[model samples]
Target chain A: MRILVAMSGGVDSSVVAGLLAEQGHEVVGATLQLYDHGAAAAKRGACCAGQDIHDARDVADRLGIPHYVLDREQVFRREVIGDFADTYARGETPVPCIRCNQTVKFRDLVALARDLGCAALATGHYARRVEGPDGAELHRAADPARDQSYFLAATTRDQLAFARFPLGDMPDKAAVRAVALRLGLAVAEKPDSQDICFVPEGRYDSLVARLRPGAVAAGDVVHADGRVLGAHGGIARYTVGQGRGLGAASWDGQERLYVAGVDAARRRVVVAPRGSLETGTATVGEVNWLIDPPSEPLRCAVKLRAREAPRAATVAWDAAAGLARVALDAPGIVAPGQACVLYDGDRVIGGGFLRAPGSVDRVPAAA
Target chain B: MPVLGLDANATEPLRPEARDAVLRALDQPGNPSSVHAEGRAARRLLEEARAAVATAFGAKPQDIVFTAGGTEANALAVRGLAPGRRVLLGATEHPAVLRAAPATAETIPVLPDGTADLAALEALLGAGGPALVCLMAANNETGVLHPVAEAAALCRRHGALLHVDAVQAAGRVPLALAGADSIALSGHKMGGPKGAGALLLRPGIDLAPLIAGGGQERGRRGGTEPLPAIAGMAAAALAARPEAAIRLAALRDAIEVGVAAAAPEARFPGRAAPRLPNTTSILLPGVAAETQVIALDLAGVRVSAGAACSSGKVAASHVLAAMGLGAEAGAAIRVSLPWNAAEDAPERFVAAWSAMRDRLSRRAA
Candidate 1:
């Protein structure tokens, strides 16, 4: 099979490309120049693509395969980075990685692979694709710590049909690294990229401020009980349930405070006691179903964040509205814009952005 | 790699004349800068090569200033002459020229045919005082030839200087150096060895040196020259026949005509424009140039995308974009027949392209 592998110049993708090439598949490696690497990524100490592009080309050279670096700067800026800034300005945590994969990595790269006569498009993602009775199904990785299924929940059904995640079945990233070392890939010892791809320096505020100017305007930090706590430099700096950085009131030792909500329109960070931060219901919008949506409420486990354990939940999907209301077994700090991915055992059902606290038409939490 | 060399514009297979000259120069080792007898012997060979290179491009030996490669030559011309005059560059000019120009230099737009808009150049020159017009004799990607003589006339009328980047056109066509104030040539592009190029200046046109070190090339360029590469460049230039260019052009025509039926969606950019005889920029609508280049390479054919960047990534061609080739900018690939291109290369390319296109279309469907 002719496979198009998305090589990030990282060990995982390099190893995937090597494995496919070893199988005698005509593998072509492609890396996206997502931003102006030299002018932007390099000076900003961000995980820019300059060195990665070099590494990917080297890997392709070693594998004796043809490689390409596609410039997706415009689309990535408009879709991922621009949306990230907009979401942040709206007082939401945006998953730029998920958006990037959904658009540039899967959608655009899949189109490119198809145009190039590739049978399947391979990636280094840590998620499994199981051939179910119906069609290809997305599943969690065997290694729980490395499971990237949540980030990939929004992968469309047609995309899953064409996508191949080769590193999914591996026990851990160590195993993938070992395979890469055995294959003599130079990126075998490369450390896992810790920060967000674009937010290389971990300064998301600056990026947001630069992209969406005036988003960093000073706002009042108000307690949920209508008490004026203090003032914050920017609403973009705080996420839901974050206790610290609540200004001087957070250190007064009165009580542990956590951000309950953010009203972007009012430019206010609503703080409350840690106890008030829990929410049993997360109204998720923009759900992309991997399996058939259950007509009725389906009891399943759910993952609120990438690193957390799956919690018990009942997901009632609304087809017409393209939203899902997940009723968690216990109250969790379901942050707005954080993915609410439902899982049936190990397979991903679907997921979407957690709605703002009061935006779901006042659906009462199962207290 | 057993790859057929169709990416002549990138760099051609070393000509035997060039190879023999390089080997000969290697055997007689001496730095042309040294004052020893061996140095004098090296200087003689260097001067002979300089004469050969200058004469081939219709310039005096004294006018040629050797550089490391075409890039240095172009940089020397643009950066050297950009002090007093306002610079007006063609939109389709090579990055070597574009990057070297003053940041304030205005761009002269190109026509839809990828030809330099001479009217725009005239308008810019008329509007500015003592402007330097930078245009390429032949575009590296599309191979579209600009009206250099006409441009020179316009520059003269406006009291502006004209610098022609003849790197791609130097050996492929007869360059009329009398038309422009200066010309930049690359050795590797014209079947010469890498690491050698020359900037040809008209008599009495004293420009600043781009590199300042040991005074070489009459203080117009500095640093000790790479003699062997220079010798090879000149040898290749001398060996290149204008008739070979004509033959290659015919072969290019055959390739376009033969592959036309199979690739109905393929477009020839600058097809109606006066393009180089040996080059063709084919735009495959659905497939990317990188994909085509790779697929063809796998099938033992070697070609290149039009705007392959510093990292060898086939990015969208700004040249095509400037010419209004919106989405197709990234889809264009250049297949330039080398000076020694075989007769069957045309058929081979057509077959390879058709097969690749067929497989791609089927896969897409």
Candidate 2:
């Protein structure tokens, strides 16, 4: 079978290509030249940018298969970058990568594979596509330490149909590296890519500044009591549940306050105690189901953020409204516009966007 | 019908004689730089090939310095000339030249027609000083010939040595050693094997050797000569005929017309300027070059984006960036053919291109 492997110049993708090639499949390795607008792309250690392409090409040569680098910068700018800027402008924290996977990387790449006359498009993502009695399903990888199912929740059905994850069944990062080493792949010892592909140093503010200079407004940081704490350099720099670098002037005897809200209209950071961070009920929009919608309020595990552990929750689906109402047993920092992925064990059930508090009419009797 | 490859700019298949020459050279036992009789025989072969390449490009045999390929040849040219000297480079030179040179290097922009800005080159030259001025005889992506003679004249006036990376222009266009102080060429671009290239320096020019080893190429470049590849390169260069370019140009024109008919929005860069007869950089807006290349490949046709060196990465070419082609660069695809492409090559290319357009249009809609 002819498989088109997506090599992102990261250890995982490089190893995936090597493993697949060793298995005797006709593998054509390809790397997507996503966005180069960020200065970090030129930096030495940055992955999936300038240097990564060369590295990917080198690996492809080593694998002895035809390799190609596809330029998807324009599509990336439209799907990922534009959406990122607009989301920030609208006071919502957006996962640019999720949008990239759904619109640019997976969808565009699978289409490219079809154009190349390949049977399937494979990536190094640590998530599984399993064929079960029910049908095709997305699942967490065997490696709990490196499971990336959370980041892949929004992948559409069409995109997932022709996708394969070779590293999905690997034991862990160590095992993957071992396989690479055993095969004499150069990237066996390469460190895992951690930073945002385009932003190696994690300075999102500078990137946002470059895109929309001075868009981050300097504003008042107010305490939960509505008293002016101090002046903030920008509201765009702050996120819900953040405590560090508040730049607050006064706090005589209170615990370090977290950012409870971002009032973009007035350009202010609403601060409060950690106790105020929890929200038992979250209304989610843009719902996508990997499994059939439950006939009743289904008891499931809901993860509100990437690293957060799944908490027991009762999920009620409103098909007509295209929303899911998640009632968590324990209150957590459920922010607006963040992805809320519902999982059953390692299987991803579905996901949706968490609506901001007060925007949607909450069921008064339920709370 | 034999495949009419219009993608020589990407890479030309090795000529049969060149392939035989490589195989013959590989059978020899001794290294050319060694002292034994077998080594002397190998050394003889090396010198003879070097002389052949020099004669083909109108230079002294001593001037031809072989390297791994055109990319390395380019790197040597850009980096060897007056280290620490402020470098001035043409906008459309390959990335190997741009990346190896200093970031502070002044860029001499190219006109929209792919001609080098001689005035800009002169301005940089006048500002002068221990400086290395780099330009290409022709643009790799656009096959548009640059004003090498005019620019070389400016370099001579300003007392700055000129380094012309003539990798794409050497055989297709007439080359004279007098135009530029130094020139770079790739054997593969002229139907030789990959991994063979030469840097031709003027007789009196002094350059810092990039690789130091047992004195070879007059101690300017190091490592045992890739005798097989060099012999093949020399053989390929000698076989190049004047009529090749004329024939290639006609085929290129036919292909361009066919493409334009299928996609009216398609653009040919440097169409009106003097260009390599075989190369065309076409821009199909609202469609990616990679997409079209892949589509063509699926239909038993092959083409490439400009600069096969950076083909795998999907970023817009730095050449295009230097030309100030922001979005248009993304839409550009290059097609190049050898003089030997089949008679039916253009028609087949047109059919493949039509199919690609239909597929892309449907995908877009």
Candidate 3:
């Protein structure tokens, strides 16, 4: 069957194409041109998409498969980039890679793949799509360290059915790159993209300021107990758990203060002791259940962010209010706008965006 | 899947005559600038090519200045102008002319059908000091013919200079360059190899060198010419038949007829306007040209969208926008039938395009 591989001019995707082609599948490559490269290339710390398009095309050519560079700047800006800024403006930490994976990489590419008459859309994502008795099942990649299932929590069940991740079984990134080198791919030694793909300079605050003006509005640094500690340049610069960059509120009475909450409309960064930052429960919205909702409260492990282990939790889905109430066994900093992904062993159960600190009040009495 | 090439405007496949000329010329040695016996042989080949291209465009051999490509030819004509001469460019002119002209140069608008608004040109000329009017003989996107002769007549009345970019029109249409002071021609556009193009000036016209290297092409353009490419271009020019342009019109129309019927909402922009017989710009609503190009390419039918940048991303065509196609600008894709486009070419393209359209529509529904 013909497969449309989303080759991002990187080694992992390049190796996926090589492996698929070696398996005798008709593999076609596509790279999305998400932004203007001319100005992008001129920037001091550019996350070079310009060179990637060329590399992807060269890899496709070497593999004797046709490659296309699709312009998705308009769509990408609206769906991924715009959402990224809005999430920050609301005083929530956002995983831009999650948003990109959910929207641009999976949702859009899957549609494009179908339109091009391809049977499946393959990606470089490190997550497995297991064919289960119930159509398809999403699972954590075999390599625990490289598991990206946290970022792919929002992937709909239908999307998973049509998507393939050949690299999901690879033991490590080095093994993938070795396959690429063995396949004679040019990007075999290309460095893994480290920072936010769009935020090349790692200046997250500046980007948020530009996209959602006034997101970086100057505000006060206050304690959780209503004590005005000092002044802060912007609440957007402070995430729920960050301890540094609070200026005068970096410490309170010889105790280091961590960011407890960010109130955007109130224009304040609430700082306090590390103990105050812990949350016993998190309210998540826009829940995407990969499995059917559990009838009784389901006991599971949940991850609140990438690079963190899933903590034991009890998650109750209130379908009427379109929200989920998660109670962690041990308190952790449940940052608003961070993803709350429910896991059952190695399988993704469901996920949703963490609700803001104040939003817990809006939860219906039905829950 | 059998692959079919349909993107003639981007470039046509090299003609056999051009291929043979290039191979035969490659055997000869010596720069045209040299004074040796081999040098004279190279010079003769160079001048013969110059005369052939000049005659093809109805100009003297001395008027033709060889440059790199259509872009350089345009840059050479538009840049280094006599001081204080106001440069007025057509809004829909190719970027080669659009960017080459001065940043402060004024623009003349175009009609809805993608034709150069001659009335606007006359007004701009009438309102100005001695001006240089830059317009294409045919649009690269829609292939709509500009009113070059009429615009030139207005320029004559205003005592202005008229420069025509005949990159698309040189071989496809009759060379009625009488009123224009200079014209640009691209070899690749006419089935010749790239890296060779010429800017034809009237007998008395001359400009400062864009490249000041060892004096070549009478110092108008410097750099030793690529002999083989120049020969290929000359051979292509000699082999191009005016009748083929007329024949391709039916094929072009057949494509329009089939595509329009299959997808009624698809706007065939320049269909009614006088355009190159081999071109069609169709706007299929709800589908971006980038998607259409990719879909068709995957189906083994090749075409292109608006002038792609170095990175192959299809930006909304300024030409379509200038013509007031508003929302449909991004929807337009150029499907230019090659010189050797077969009778079944249109059917194959329309079939692939329509199937892709139907699938997308179904998915949307």
Clash totals, every prediction: 0, 7, 0
lDDT of 1 by residue, A89-153 (tens): 88887888889888999988888787676889999999999999989999998888888899898
The RMSD of every model to the true structure, in order and in angstroms, is: 3.2, 6.1, 2.5
- Candidate 3: RMSD to truth: 2.5
What range of 10 consecutive residues in model 2 chain A has the weakest lDDT sum? A358-367
Candidate 1 lDDT by residue in tens digits, B1-365: 45678988999789999999999988767889889999999999999999998778778999899999989999999988889899999999999999899899999999999888888888888886899899999999989999889999999898899999999998888887597888999888888899999899988888989777888888988898888899999998998877677799899999999878888788999998998889999998967777788778767898887666676666778888999998889888898989889998888889888999898888778
lDDT at position B219, candidate 3: 89
Tens-place lDDT per residue, model 2, B1-365, is 34345677767778887888889888887899888999999998898889889889889898889998898888888888848688888888888788879878988888877788888777777775867888888787888888888887887887777899888887787875486877888988888888789999888876777898877878888888899989999988888765687888888899899989988888887897888888888887877777777667646677777555324554566666566677777778888887578867888988878777777777668
Candidate 3 lDDT by residue in tens digits, B252-299: 989999998998888888877899998899899877788888888888
Give the CAPRI rating of model 2. acceptable
The Cα local distance difference test for each model comes to 0.86, 0.79, 0.87
lDDT of 3 at B86: 96
Which of 1 and 3 is ahead in lDDT? 3
Off by over 4 Å in 2: A1-29, A33-67, A71-97, A110-149, A157-276, A285-302, A307-332, A342-350, A355-367, B1-6, B27-39, B80-87, B119-133, B154-160, B309-311, B320-326
DockQ of 1: 0.49
User: How high is the DockQ of candidate 3?
Assistant: 0.58
lDDT string for model 2 (A1-367, tens) is: 7889999777789888888888888788888877663345455534534766777887888888777777677777777877666566555677776777777778778888876667888999999999877776889999888898888888766667788898999998898888878877787787777657766568777767667554476888888789888888776677678887786533426676888887877878788888887788988877778877777999989999888889999999987667789899988897665789999998898887777775652322110
Docking class of 1: acceptable
Top candidate, metric TM-score: 3
